[model samples]
Target chain A: MTVDVGICSTDHVNAEVYAALLSELPDANLVGISGESRERVRKQANSVGAAAMSHQELMDAADGVVICSTNAAHKALVDLALRNDVAFLCEKPLATSLATAREIRDRCAESDVVAGMAMPIRYSRPMRRLKEQYEAGAVGELIAVSGVNRGRMPGGWFVDPEQAGGGAVADHTDHIVDIVRWITGEEIEEVYAETTTRFYDIPVEDVNLLSMTLSNGASFIMDGSWSTPQKNSFWGDADVELVGTEETLAADCFGYRYDHVSDTGHGRHTESIYWGADPNNALLRDFVAAIRGESTLAAAATVDDAVRTAAVIEAAYESVERGEPVDVDR
Target chain B: MRQIVAVGPETAVRAHVERYDRFDDAAIAGLVGVSEACADGIGAPRYESVSDALRETDADGVDVCGPGAVHGDALREALDAGVPARCDPPFALDGDAFDGLVSLASDGEGWLTAYSPHRFSRLYDRLRTDVDAGAIGSIGVARIKRTAPFDGAGWNSSYAGISAAADPVDALCAVLAHDADVLEWTFGAVERVFARARSGGRYDHVHAMFAFREGGRATIETTWSDEWTPEPRVDVEYSGNQGRLHFDEHDTLTALRNGGDHGQVAPPGDDCRGGALRAFLERIEGEERPPSAVDPEGPSRAVVAVRRSVAEGRPVTLTEEGSR
Candidate 1:
């Protein structure tokens, strides 16, 4: 059966990436797109060969809607889906703050509509293999978990504090945090982060270094920064490493690449190109499969998972403000 | 005798391919670079990448090439297989990993050593001689600037693997680590450090100022831009209370001092890497241990301190008493 997927917005990695992913999945159809901007939504819908829709109309027509708006705008769309009884998939962080994230997750739990967090990196083949190995005791009891999710600064509502909720720390940290939580099944309990605006001139921070403690007492450090320059960086990265008593497991979703050297008559310069299958395709495939009650290829994160990540990020921001370690307060 | 294999990405072990015939004792045989395309070089490709291949690979001795991040695990696998191993600079990042390797090496069956080909080079050998001869007496400050016009460090993720190459520490491990070794080797142990790193994408520029425990200071600046040069251009200058000494990539050394007499000699440019490899093999054979082949704990400590200084936006005491 075809899974009719409607996009809620078309900005940055949401509308464009989802359309590209849907184009690859035969069972998933681009039914419609709903956004605050009618013209923009119509433009995106035309590009993807789908209908332009309002918030409620998209929910009424499609089987599920992807919350692709800015971070702060996620709660409203999720609330709309909760009331409409429409299955919804949300891009990471769940919401801008812990309170809102908890509210959305609590409401979704009370309802019957399917709610999933769009952590596409969970589908990376290397990470999936590592996770399986960890589960099978390839690595003994976990000693520590460290990760990095460095990316090119995506200019949009993401740079705006109000619209995006937070800055580079939240934007990049949540992805790795979710993956760590998934692999270890332990929530991050304490957070101490050092964040600064080193890359861009925007108000929100771009460089983040965090030290966290998991419920199992394993330590975690993350370099979640907008340090990838648009001109030179090969691609964004989502890397995680788990150290156990016996072994250390590491995987980088966007790590496979080769250097491409070409002269454009300017000078001898080298460009790094990513060489691997896109994980976004697998993420959307599993989301569609979960919606259809099929065996999911990559299990989509639930609302509770997203809330846990949000709690860690919220505590991280507090750690940055207070200049010390703070409890995650989950 | 058994041949020692160089296992890592192609470019990292490329020097081994060209100078393979020069080694008298050790033969560069199987699994040179980890890539499939690099199989036809000096050694035949036996395994794919560094993932689990070293756990039980067939080699009497191994050279762990590529980034400094994976050095610990890779070395562990080699030693665990009862194969003596040597690694490229900045041996390992974590103190625990370094200490673990030391403990494993202490077990006696398979030994681990650091690879500093330059230490075996005539150029650095003479540089050390000049320092010993007090050519630049009572050195007050030292500076090294490296500008790589043609080094493909930007796309290092190609061969070094994702786990090794693509972080802000990429330059720190590959570029600055080489210089940090020289800086620490030339000066005494580092007591404190302050560093500032600005990433144009993946941390292409790095600057760090160091204060040595023996009452001297030094500064290091390195840039890995897209400008193409086959070899990285490194310029070193030492300013002293008595005189100054300077050197560049051209194999020429300049020295000047207060009391008049100063001697100049050209350092060896080519054919030294093979000698370095031969010496490393001898060390593996239980001959005299090679210089710069220890735990390299000082450089590792400096790297950790540099990272902390960058994160905290302040100076960090590297060798503080009772500090990890």
Candidate 2:
């Protein structure tokens, strides 16, 4: 069935959603654009050739929707989408707070709607190869992994505590946490985190180190800090190295790049242009395939994964507060 | 020039002798085998014991290139005689031996240090300089990874202390001294450790996390894999509040800016290939060299803590004195 997809909210994430949808699903109809601001919605709708509509109207009319709103607004939008029996794809975090995330997850379970969470990292070429290699026994029984997902602190609503939820720990922690679990086929059993606010004066922490133990007794420590520079630098990274009984393997999804230094954009800056396959394209392709009932979303994250990772992230915050290790809420 | 006696098995002493070929200020004077009787140790006069070798030869320093088992005794024999000596990693097999050697080294007229190709490599020398100068700022996390081909036969035969008879986990911990030494030199003493190890058929892989006394943390992963490689993987990464520093070899260092740009590399340097023997001789010759090998006291304690952590299946805390 050809699906009519509407995008709800064109706030911070609206551009990527529009670009990715068109790049991956060229023939798919973008029927509606909805947001809190009518003017912004109208402008984005015109730009993307989508019709501006209310969130309720968009949900009722379109077969599915993509919510790129701020972190806190996810649950409400998801509730509306589920009530209309409209399938939807939510961004990185399902919701801001764990309580809100759990409520959204439960609501998702009760509905027959096709829901997906945007964890595009697993779709990267290097990460996909890393997972395939592990499953192919490239390394024997994997015992430990050390991963880093460091990014520049994106200012604006991302730094806003209520809008983006937490700081670096929240924003940066999700990608590698999702990768580690997805690649290794193991759930994080516990987490011990030490967090600090550095590089950015935002109300949230920009640096965080989390030592996590996997369900199979293997362990990994992820340095998921938003420590990159926003200007004159490559955006961020998702790199991991795993050790197993027979061998060791490493992958950097964003590592293959052409380093260029020139008096360009920001005046005398060095940045790497990553020539790797765009992960967002792959993620949206899988989401669209699942929405059209053509295939299951093996390449994209489902709503349940969002809840589990939220539990880990929530426990990490708790562990930092308690100054000790905390059991991941399963 | 300094003449050091290579004390160990033929294979072990030859490893030290080979390093001497690259040094200008040092030469292997003689050899003393630990267990088996060895003839002409690669043209150097072979002796029965450390005392006998020192008693007969004009050797001024001792190089305990023996297995982990005899490192404590051979290095002790020289240091106690007020002779500057260097030994292969672990320095000692057990806590008592380690404590004894540390005490003697502190009081000895001649200095003592451990021998490692990596620590003495031009690679780490420059990195150590950068780290000491805070080029990357105050680092909160440092990760070190080492992987080499597991020499199963040689480990069982020559390395007695770390032979399969010992607890495999402890044996592996004993071998991780070089990695621990790097951490100790860069960061200060580790206050606590949480270690986990796995054995396929041989206990050859382990992951150990350290909480530094100087307000930082580190993860050290060492693996002796079944696959063969021309060179071992040596990855050292330091994540600081300001910037990050990472390197795997002597030629280049990928320096990340305060807001990290991963592709940045420091300019290549003049081939500054300093060896352990050269470092020891420089200290004996009193040249006031920059950044010699650190005291093995901290690394020894870390090994002990890692062993205990693996044994207890929990995190082990190290006190100022030792493992608590």
Candidate 3:
């Protein structure tokens, strides 16, 4: 049975990559593509040998919708999907604003709709294995976790805090949130975040660091930045490592390669092979599986998760403004 | 651990394979550069094109230092080839492509990543000790402030792109994520956060607050884009009920055991960084506790919390029991 998908977005991730994902899944049918431009949509669809249609047409034809549009459009598209009674998968950061996210969440809940967030990092095999280790007591006792997703900036909507929802924090924070939530299966208690805009002239933040306590008495720390010095070829990279009580595992979850090539000296270098599978595909596969009644949506990040993340982001900004820790109101 | 075959334009290819000479003999490696002059002394098989590089190398991994525009495809190609890789950061030119790369990495196994040369830095190693020792006593608060100025083209080019356009607080997110080796190595989980970004002259800045799984808290601010006469500096302060730890790359253990000094005894030496790295390498060699690089998911999860904090601007908590 082929699962039909409608990718909705003008962004590069949606337009190009999602299309490729569609091609990878033999059972997935790229029925339609929708975004801001007809030409671009057609190109994206054509690239994957899929059909292109207007957003509404694609929404109506598809069994499930992949909302890859900008943050602002999340509510509108989700509402459209709900009204159409279609299951949906949305990119991380369900919305740019809390109110809008709430509206989408409420509608989905009211409709008893199935919605999954595109927090693909949770699906990584390493993460899955780590979670298992934590559960199995491989680490003796789960202690703590920390992460960084720093890189030089990539301009565009990312520069506009509103569109991208506050730069590095908005872009980088979700991955950290989802990973922690998935790994420990814990809930965030209270949150107080302080943010600053000092690196870039853009309206939003270029660098951000956030910390939180889980319900389990565990502590987590995360940092994100678009600040690495740009080189001739590579822009930036991401890495993930974890520590447990009994054991520890460190891997380049992002598969960043570091090597030394000398022109006049003996060259020594290192590279990485990505053996980890994509969490997004797993996310989509999970969503599709849930829709097919083959499996339950146990691991997927939901609208509620996005809401919590939003609430945290809101508090972080407030904390920055107040120069003090701000409690996150449940 | 991973094999690489250099790929670029014709004149840029190297003739011999360059394995990591600095590390263990077990390590596998590759190189990719644009100039043969760049690849001259490097012992790696350099290809004229990425396609050839993929075909020529039996690498389980590929490190892309290719041109920017083609980076998306380069990463896609590596992942498509079922080869995990560590590419330069800013992962892509836009969010969509970058997100796609992330999606790809997540889907693939052995796909771990981080930016900045600091994760491998010595200071990070030392800091991990204090965190793991619980020396700070539950880490009530962790604060970091990083500042740098743009001297000219050096400052502009290096800091301009994202640092100039994005929030410095986001930079904190990246740093925290990368340095998170300490956090994940110590605490256990992460959650709850808020964030804000603003502009200060040509510099971009970001500030953020976070809630740790337990009762811990963190705040960070990053300043970049402009050049000042003074060099660069970072101030890290960790506070606990017992005492506080002050660290500044150049000068660590600046302030400890103040105001009663936590009433503790027995302090470790300051060689924590080297010790940790040595430990890391030992773990890698299967002679120690466990290697930090073995599992990459937990750290990524911490990063996700940071993203949630920035996106929601409200508290994002982890699902961990009691920590909340």
lDDT of each: 0.67, 0.71, 0.56
* Residue B256, candidate 2: alpha-carbon lDDT: 40
Per-residue accuracy of model 2 over A24-92 as CA lDDT, tens digit each: 376467888888889988887887778889999898788877888888888888999999988888886
lDDT of 1 by residue, A193-286 (tens): 6565645568898766676777986667666767655655365578887655555567988778899898899987778887788787877877
The DockQ-based CAPRI class assigned to model 1 is: incorrect
Q: Alpha-carbon error at A285 in model 3, in Å?
A: 2.4
Weakest 10 consecutive residues, lDDT, candidate 2 chain B?
B264-273
User: Per-residue lDDT tens digits of candidate 2, residues B1-324?
Assistant: 788888765655655566576667777677877433454436778777787888888887887663343456677778778777766466664567766777776766656766443465456667788889987677666777766443321111123223322445555665576668777877777887777676663226677878787767777877654334424456677776667777663333233434432332322111211255566666677754224332566777788777777666566778866675
Off by over 4 Å in 3: A12-14, A140-143, A192-194, A228-252, A255-275, B1-324
Candidate 3 lDDT by residue in tens digits, B30-58: 44545555655564554555556777766
Q: What's model 1's lDDT at A320?
A: 68
The TM-scores, one per candidate, come to 0.55, 0.82, 0.50
Q: Number of the top candidate by lDDT?
A: 2
- Please, what's the RMSD in Å of model 3? 25.5
**Candidates arranged by lDDT, highest first:** 2, 1, 3
Off by over 4 Å in 1: A258-275, A295-298, B1-324
Q: After superposition, how far is residue B245 of candidate 3 from its true place, in Å?
A: 24
Candidate 2 clash pair list? none
Q: Taking the tens digit of each residue's C-alpha lDDT, what string does model 3 give over A65-150?
A: 78888776788888888888778878767777667777778888888667878777777766777677677766444444556666
lDDT of 1 at A1: 98
